[model samples]
Target: DQQVKQNSPSLSVQEGRISILNCDYTNSMFDYFLWYKKYPAEGPTFLISISSIKDKNEDGRFTVFLNKSAKHLSLHIVPSQPGDSAVYFCAAGEMNRDDKIIFGKGTRLHILP
Candidate 1:
């Protein structure tokens, strides 16, 4: 079974608008969540991360929120720019357990002008 799931395969948002990417998980053992952004022909780079102890974590234009009860998380980008267009992957794993992190299929985000 897939532990991490990104229901939306793709998303489109106009420039200067907020883009929200949603994700869900089935594993309650996950104590950490991470978001990664990848451009074509390039490896994914870490965007932001959140611990189960916290509900939200922000880094500049990106923010990640975790809802433990709902087993859901989301990434919000304010003033989405064209450069922000990429595939975003939601990952989750237990920090103290193993090094294996489950990843979603990824959601392709298109930032329109």
Candidate 2:
């Protein structure tokens, strides 16, 4: 079974608004979580991350929140811009798994101008 899951295939948001992406995981061993943004014809780039010890992490307009007890996580982008449109992947890694990470299918976000 896929440990990480992004139930929403896509989402849309207006420019200068907020964008929220959700993710779920079945594996409790995951100690680290990350969000990556991908563009067409290019590889995914790391965005933000949070350790199990922390519930929230933020960088500028991007923020990530993790709920270990619920095995859920989310990414929030404030004042979304058109350039923020892309496919975002939620990834998780277990500390003892040799640093191998598991990624969700991905959720495509569209920013409307």
Candidate 3:
């Protein structure tokens, strides 16, 4: 199965605090992992990514960690801002014949003022 699961559907965080989102996959062939953030009524935008061989990847306030053996990955946001309040999706994929991505259901993040 190509299911990517985000067990938590939502999270609430205070501004300037850290937010963590967790994901799990059952497919071992997935070599590339991605995190996407979405605002209301908008398509998700890519936030960060990591290859299966890498344990960690970071971009400014965002960090992504992957553990292939555990089939697990997480996204962390430090000092999360109000703008960061949105749905986060985790995706796992191998290069398709046409090279596209498959995404998870997503977790909504709510930043408290």
Best by lDDT: 1
The best-first sequence of candidates by TM-score reads 1, 2, 3
User: Tens digit of lDDT per residue, candidate 1, span 1-113?
Assistant: 99999999999999999999999999999999999999999999999999999999999999999999999999999989999999999999998986789999999999999
TM-score of each prediction: 0.98, 0.97, 0.93
**In candidate 2, residue 102 scores what lDDT?**
96
Q: What tens-digit string does per-residue lDDT give for candidate 3 at 1-113?
A: 54799999999999999999999999888899999999999988989999887899999999999988899999999989999999999998995435777788999999999
Clashing residue pairs, candidate 2?
Answer: none
Task: Give the CA lDDT, 0 to 100, for residue 13 in model 1.
Answer: 100
Q: How does candidate 2 score on lDDT?
A: 0.96
List the lowest-lDDT window of 10 residues for candidate 1.
93-102
Worst 10-residue lDDT window for candidate 3 reads 95-104
31: Cα error in model 3, Å: 0.6
Which wins on lDDT, candidate 1 or candidate 2? 1
Task: List the pairs of residues colliding in candidate 1.
Answer: none
**Stretches of candidate 2 exceeding 4 Å from the true structure:** none
